[model samples]
Target: MEDIIDKRMVDQSEMSYTVDILNKGVGQVAKKLLEESSELAFASVEQKSTADIVHEAADLIFHFLIMLKATGLTLNDVSEELESRHKN
Candidate 1:
């Protein structure tokens, strides 16, 4: 996913949503993360189908990766934090 994002960013393809959000800067990325999270929360609260929940979850995670990239972080950084907590 990071590779795809980097390629899209470099290619600057007008058709790529990743490029669009990244071009808009971190604020837009954060806004999208909030939006996706809200959709996931709504799906859960409304007792939507499992598929709906999973779909929303995937959206949230994809945006999360975008957010991490925008912030110069990576999944490994996040995993390390989680691992530290697990050991605590």
Candidate 2:
């Protein structure tokens, strides 16, 4: 995903939806994250199929990564924080 973002940012010739969304800026990305998370939560509450839940979860994680990139952070950064908290 990081590679996709970097490549798309450098080469505009390719049509990548992820890049398009990222280009829309953090506000849009955050909105997607919220939407996806809501869908996931509602799906869980509605007792949707396992596949449906997984789909929503993937969407949420995708937007989450985009948010992290926009904010100049990474999964490692989040992991480090989690590790520190676990040790406390």
Q: Best candidate, lDDT-wise?
A: 1
- lDDT per residue, candidate 2, 1-88, as tens digits? 7666667767988868777888899999999999999999999999999999999998898888888888889888999999999899
TM-score of each candidate structure, all chains considered together: 0.89, 0.89
* Candidate 1, 15-83: lDDT as tens digits: 689988877999999999999999999999999999999999999999999999999999999999999
Clashes of 2: 0
lDDT of 1 at 82: 97
TM-score of 1: 0.89
